[model samples]
Target: MALNFEPELPTFVFERTYTNDHQFLFAFPNEKKMPNARQIQLRRLYDIMNLSVQRNDLPRARRAWSILARCKEINWKAMWRLGITLLGNDARVMESNPRKIDYLRTMLLQLPEERERILAELVQHYILAGKYRDALDELEFYLPSFPYRDNPVLHVYAGLLCIFVAQPPESAGVNEVEETAFDSNSLSRAQIFLEHAKALDPHNIVASEFLHKLHSISQGPASISFASHDSEDETHTKGCQPSQPKRKRSNS
Candidate 1:
């Protein structure tokens, strides 16, 4: 009995190697490997882009952004805001390069969530560039949609642009009949937009003021100066969202 009391020694012992890579039996092939060199580079580039933007180093940010945009793994649609900022941040550059507007227009389609906001910015840019017709066209194109249909500010913008375009040209060669017809159509469109704006936002002073101007125009020959209302519109836009700061005023 005493001789049989010796316990049998275990043949094998389980020990985990701390340095060994552990792979789960059900892990996917992609999950088992570390990030590829390209992935790491792309991640670094994103960091660079953000850092450069914060520092106001637009050129550097743009460089990084360009590279990142070309990467197949990067989702440019979600990154549209960054692209817009890079392309439109510099007032002089934007003014000199009309291509920036085209870029913004293209990017507008890619971002559904931010489409309304981006469209607003695009319209403002067009106004600043003295492209009143283009701005009105853009507003017309989008304002018929669901959320855009309800945007009071956009309606106001459209209304203002319409009034501006409706002004009779100083050129004497212009046919009176055609000019009258054009003005009539434009003023009608402007009236509708301004009324829609007022209906949407009863407290929108811009719409109220413009509507008054429209009424005066109908009574007699009246001059409604859009230049004076630019600052007012911008002020209201800023007040609408106190948390979000508006873009810098372009020197151009």
Candidate 2:
């Protein structure tokens, strides 16, 4: 004879336990993790860019381009589109706010494949901002990467920057001896770069002109006067956007 087991245990006890377990699993999904975070981000980037272009909103475009640039892995086509948008935005930034030059540099570094082309634009931006020293530093950093053996134009810019950095603004009240020493060192450095530029390309008319002017300034008057090195940027394309391909979002 079996004892009355049904009365001892509640029939709904197992049902209650199952409900609690379901709630716990829903609250903390340990077994099933969310997927396609990158794809989702990329989709958002596309949407932002598309809307920005339709609205002709530069600020929005810039924000989206920056986000894409910072992404660790982006498709080649997406990266190219981002670079083009940023290139246009950077030109405006250079004209309005020169201090954002560092941010522009960071954006350029994000797209490694387009580094040379973007770096050339960056150098021009620095020149336009009256930052000769900064421009020279960038030019020197990338000079070795240039396809040519030596960039005579880059050398000319570097030499000009050296002269600018050496020449003290008239306001700094320094003794004649100190001024002479500082100017001498700067002139020596400038001479080295200019000479190298001439050696690289004897027919470089700009280098030749710079050297002639430098010599004239040196001999005619002990007073050092600087010339403007702000060069025009021909790479800037206003109101331009790269065509983006249709990309599918992962549904995983």
Candidate 3:
């Protein structure tokens, strides 16, 4: 038996690598920046959300508001902040948290009842999130109270909502609807919106184009007639045919 004694490193100084016990205690601190709860519990959700936006941690940033959501007290400014931050990928996270539904409902409700652009955005957000039911609910929430926009794109927006989002019919299709699938439904709704848009702003190309495209996609005629704007192009005037390819008059 050989005995070699060295001064013990005082147990504290001595180091042990792996604990023979597989269950040795080890600890790690939570490093992930969890949404700060107390900060946004009510008045602070806006601040936390702003911080999230500053970091471009849009998902977690928006999630921060889940803390104080359902309040419905956040006005258009706050709602806009949250609504715009919602991106395509955020939908999954939103679906996971039931808080998402509350946030959206409150957000839409808070927007000025007549703010069509915000309503469009709200619709777009719901559509991206694949919440068709919610999207439809949004339309129902908005369409009635909305003052008709004087925008040229108004019809396009309305048609899209009615046919695709709102599920309108085809037989009542607009003039441009040539006949694609649900040609009748899409055309009809498209016609309705486009007509509305045209009625609002007769010379708007955006409205004209949307109607033209919808009808074209449905196999309808490619042209539409509308009065030109103040800065109108004579060649592209309403009812004017596309210019023919000019032939080069070259003689050998």
Candidate 4:
């Protein structure tokens, strides 16, 4: 009888076993169980891009990012920060490549969630690149919109840019009527923006200082020297220095 009967197997012993990876896949069926060819390629490119950036190999990083940007599966909107970093890696290089600005503008359209922040950054970049008119235009275009209209910092930037463009060039010969009209319009706009900024954030130092300067400018040439005012304004608005003469304060 002992020879004829075999020992009963336990129920657990008969159950199929799954590894951790299998369990994970089972838990998240909607997720990809394994990387497809495209995903694998993208992952490799991402690694290369990050490593190249870390190594300061901008060319290599740009190449990798370019590929990733073109891929259909890639969510470039989510990766906009990385794109900004790559595009702005070299300030000198970026100055020559206007396409980078265009690319940022394109991203601005694609990333609605980050629109305000991106627009602010884009305006700052334009200011740094000595494109005062362009920066002001950008602010004007967005200032009527939802979030930008309410943003105090953006109002300050707009106000500063207005003051900048209002200044008449020292060497340029132009029609007196046109110059006067332009200056009048710009100063008016600057006052409006600065007042708006002050109203939005009363504690904003930049807005308050600029408002005072604007008021002093209105009081006539004798009340405030343009050279001194310009220098003081530039000091308050960091990274937005206009391409103007940096004159020393006259000691009389």
Candidate 5:
């Protein structure tokens, strides 16, 4: 008798193609199959890099770096994952691998096509590295672009990075007045980003979650010390709340 059970479908169709035997798994024919294969390799590369970090295996990490460098074309998502892998817990490895990061960034940014996509990945890299200002600058650079403006994820990321910018500076003797002003500015910017993201896609849970955090943080004693810059005329002045559309009642 045949078994009557069926497996659950993968959340992502292409993610199913990846396996531990990455080399053989991705050896498919033609460029059409390359996208899926490349995505698999990117994930595998992160594992390889993590292993390298755990074992302090420089040669293995180098091998992964070489493979990434040799890739003919890579998407923004892969680039973002690879950059995070490069910035893993291994401080020694990160210091030694600066060239790899530089190479990847240059390769991605220099590409004539999909500059916005590459810029988005770069923002991810900067954020992961705790370079919040750099991440914000990158987002601002692309903000005017229609593609960036249309993407909800970019807004979410910008808002997240802006929160980092609001963090208290590590330096001593930071004037309370100046710090408060900076915090207010950063929070306002973050609110705008999250609000825009919610407006664009009401169903985005990430944006919703960030908005909640923004509200919580805003009310916290630390954030309360900062002056509010919200305008009186705006309906959603607080910026934590998304405007809800009116529902029509119908006869049953």
Candidate 6:
């Protein structure tokens, strides 16, 4: 069966962006003149976006997106908010149809100049692409004195993504054959998780709970036993013992 990547028909007016929009309310002198116009417009946009998403109809989505891009209203804020809603909505979609997600990603990035907004979407993109490594790389980037306010959601998503991505393949489904590839700098990761947990909630008990969990891992447990130097050499020799060495592929 073909994928229905587009969002369900959007009742754009009913979406909080238009429903609770003070600007849309105040745009007209008579509040009730456009009583439900917001709802109708919202529904129209939703349907279009939904159709585009489900069908991977980039052309259609891009056309609808173009309208949002040029919006010069005082409350351009709602547009960005709508974009954010897509992030949450499409998280699982990205995981399944990573390439198709590029349609929204390219548009969102182009239209949004705010670092926080861009980073939030970027994090979602990487998560959808199953490129946790890149997502981890982004966390190290600092957004000092950013023009746009920081989003707590980014912190939360980053923490969850880090935990899910950093696990060993055997546990995380990355690769038992490449368990040796898991970086030894996992202590640093533990630190990141705790920090995000803290940022997500300073007084909350869960941050402390996760921090404690990370602390235990960083300290190194007695349960995990490393091989001796002699054993390491023995394993290395066994790896080279194959009758023929496989040729490495070069990406030419």
TM-score of each: 0.62, 0.49, 0.43, 0.65, 0.49, 0.44
Candidate 4: tens digits of C-alpha lDDT, residues 1-252:
345432222232112333223221112112355755444445556667777777778898887777666666666677776676687666234342465678779978888888888888787667556566677778887887788899998998899878767765544454532334336777899999999999999999888888888787776623342334544334333333354442333343
Model 1: per-residue lDDT, tens digit, 128-177? 56565667777887788778999999999888777766665534244552
- Top candidate, metric TM-score: 4
Between prediction 2 and prediction 3, which has the larger lDDT? Answer: 2
Clashing pairs in 5: none
Model with the higher TM-score, candidate 2 or 6: 2
What's the lDDT for all of these models? 0.64, 0.53, 0.44, 0.66, 0.56, 0.45
* Tens digits of per-residue lDDT for model 2, 106-209: 75667676565556656666656655555666665565554422667666766666665555454545464235533566667777888888999898766676
Candidate 5 lowest-lDDT run of ten: 232-241
In candidate 4, residue 166 scores what lDDT? 71
Model 6 TM-score relative to the real fold: 0.44
List model 5 lDDT by residue over 1-252, tens digit each. 976543332234234555544343232223344345455655556456456755767567756665655544433334444454554445354332344346546756566465567666666555445455655666766665667798887887777666655655435254653344346787889889989999999998877876886787766625432223232111111222122232333333
142 Cα displacement, candidate 3 (Å): 3.6
- Checking candidate 2 for backbone clashes, the offending pairs are none
Q: Judged by lDDT relative to the true structure, which candidate is superior, 1 or 5?
A: 1
Q: Which stretches of candidate 6 lie over 4 Å from their true place?
A: 1-114, 143-166, 171-184, 196-200, 204-206, 219-252
RMSD of each: 17.4, 19.0, 21.1, 16.1, 16.0, 13.3
Better of 2 and 3 by TM-score: 2
Which residue ranges in model 2 land beyond 4 Å of their true spot? 1-56, 62-100, 107-113, 128-131, 140-149, 172-182, 228-252
